[model samples]
Target: MQVISVNVGRPRPNPGKGADLTGIDKRPVNGAVAVVVPGPKGTGEVGLVGDRVYDVKHHGGTDQAVYAYAREDLDSWEADLGRSLGSGAFGENLTTAGVDVNRALIGERWQIGPDVVLEVSSPRIPCGTFQGWLQQQGWIKRFTRAALPGAYLRVIVPGQLRATDPIQILHRPDHEVTVELAFRALTLEPELLPQLSAAEALPEEARKRALRRSSTG
Candidate 1:
């Protein structure tokens, strides 16, 4: 695993579109190389500590050649150019390798630094801000629906992360409720709720959401 790039950020809106249009640079988050967290840093399996940046698909994206987001669709589907299913930019803080991050279930963990271990929380969803980042309309929606279930991670441990460090898949949860499966089942199939309920680590709040949404959609 190689360090794709080191991304730092500040409190800002969506950075760019498809790693091309978002003009915001990801070098300084509120003017610090890193930041401190109360417990852990972020929500997804990979956490953005200092500046709120995203570690998108690993191998690459639809745009350009390869990408910084470590987890790529190569792990799940067939993509020739090595693209992230998410139309993301290159400002991800830590790029990872050797893992289909979309398949990372909740309760999954990764040892980021001596002091930082991250946990998978939820699949990264598309939002309106992504449109602004890419300078196009419906970009976020298309990516979320088409290519992948981009993910976010919460830092379980807090330490320093320099660029070029190796990203290791330290742990994988035993549950089979992958983010991709849940995304499809939650959005397309409600009969899978029983399977979801089988996840021993499924959070109560998220389980409620799943059950409620399944009933309606």
Candidate 2:
């Protein structure tokens, strides 16, 4: 697998984004970008250099330092939506090819290029920013039903990343809680939240969320 494009966000006004000043507009970059783990949930820091997120409370953190989406999945969406989706259409940092990103295990590790190592943390959850950016009616519900949310990753090893960089699976946790399964558990199938505990290596915040939901249920 390889990176088709490395994207970073650009600030743009959006009245629909509520109090947030910027809309979700990410564009592909031409050269290498640095990837590093951010500090905390409200830090608004991300792995990719020059990439920014307007909503610090919801978007950036160590748990979501990077977002990756498969070109194949985007192609599927393009066919279904009857429109073309360029790289970074979903606000993903990396647009990848030949990778089953959604099916990746929660704790799987990917070595990008030669230096960067990113661990799968969670799945991207649909938000108002995303729906407004796409201008799609009922998009949140539609996306949730589709259950194709891309993967969010935490930077385990910092390095530079660029388009066409090779992606290697350095490690895979022995867990059945794939990215898709996590997405489904969080959004569609709350019943499965308890099962996510088997993915011991999953990000702590995500694991706690699942266990909390399961216990409350």
Give me the candidate number with maximum TM-score. 2
Task: Pick the lDDT winner.
Answer: 2
Off by over 4 Å in 2: 213-217
lDDT of 1 by residue, 1-217 (tens): 5333456444354444333222223552322234244322232122344433333332111111111344455234226324443312534444456556667675576665445555665555554445565455566655556636545555556566555455666777767887666655555455666556555444454578666755675
Q: Once superposed on the true structure, which residue ranges of model 1 sit more than 4 Å away at CA? A: 1-3, 10-49, 52-68, 71-91, 186-194, 199-204, 211-217
Q: lDDT by residue for model 2 over 133-212, one digit each (tens)? A: 88999999999999899999999999898999999999998778999999998888888989898887667876898789
Candidate 2 CA-lDDT value: 0.88
Q: What TM-score does each of the candidates earn?
A: 0.62, 0.95
Query: What lDDT score is found at residue 61 in candidate 2?
Result: 81
